[model samples]
Target: MAKHYPPLPISIWRHPAHILAFGFGSGLSPKAPGTVGTLAAVPFVWLAMQYSLMPYLIILLVASLVGIYVCDKTARDLRVHDHPGIVWDEFVGYGITLIAAPDTSYALLLAFFWFRLFDIAKPWPIRVLDAKVHGGWGIMLDDIVAGMFAWVAVQLSYLLWQLF
Candidate 1:
């Protein structure tokens, strides 16, 4: 059976945290909000790519920290823990996936696929963390781990491509 969620309140637009936690409205999508939010992050990732890796990592770090607060706050306001509409974690996760990726469209696309796969599959420790944790930390940790898993996959793939 499909799980049902209550419709979001209009106040999501009026609050800065809500706006960001929702991924600038990308999370408002009625279907697959997480995927939409992740896709929405691609442009920002591209923009981050314009700078050196140091800057990109710093931005990713800040975003991850902020995401914990925003996601927790949004979920608390909604009286739901880790509501589906709260997708700031996805944004941070996708960012982590591409930290060392080449500045190419194909690399970005590949990273996206890998990140989504790990996120959705939630293998081993990712699944364990998702189930065991709670609050903002819980909301972000699983995706962060997913991003790390995807990062390894992406880096290995790139290395293999170079070797051939």
Candidate 2:
């Protein structure tokens, strides 16, 4: 059985916070850690959707604040900048994508896939920002940009699908 752990600044695999922040080792997936991390966020979104937006926003805000430090520390420990296992950025990015989205399984899944696509594509500004920015904020900003792109795509898809 998989053991639940939390995010922490020290040892990543052992820390409960790190484990949760890394999406229960989904981020550790050999291929496309970011993709796995974003996918892992789907359940949290479902739960968050049950609560008021304010509370959800609050949790996202806290993660954003701590992500800076945790990301940095994890990167240092892993000997890589913005290591894939340090996927708190993906968590926040997915949260952004889901903002105001309908509370439906399909909607959440759509947002999840779209966010993952944009994050991987890293087009235009997202790629530019990812390259230019540095440190925790940089790590977070690329995902944020990707999330914004995904958000737009989700809205457009929703409208178009409704029209059809």
TM-score of each: 0.96, 0.85
Q: Model 2: per-residue lDDT, tens digit, 38-135?
A: 87888877788788888878887887878776666566565566666768899889988987789998888899889989988889999889888877
- Runs off by more than 4 Å, candidate 1: none
lDDT for model 2 comes to 0.78
Residue 55, candidate 2: C-alpha displacement in angstroms? 2.1
Pairs in steric clash, model 2: 5-16, 6-16, 6-17, 6-18, 7-16, 7-17, 7-18
Candidate 1 Cα RMSD after full superposition onto the native fold (Å):
1.1
Best by TM-score: 1
Best-fitting candidate, scored by lDDT: 1
Q: For model 1, name the residue pairs that clash.
A: none
- Summarize candidate 1's per-residue lDDT along 1-164 as a digit string, tens digits: 33688777557888898999999999999999989999999999899988898999999999999999988889888888778878899999999999878899998899999999999888999999988999899999999999999999999999999999
Kindly give the stretch of ten consecutive residues in candidate 1 with the minimal lDDT sum.
1-10
Q: Could you tell me how far off, in angstroms, the CA of residue 95 lies in candidate 1 after the best superposition? A: 0.6
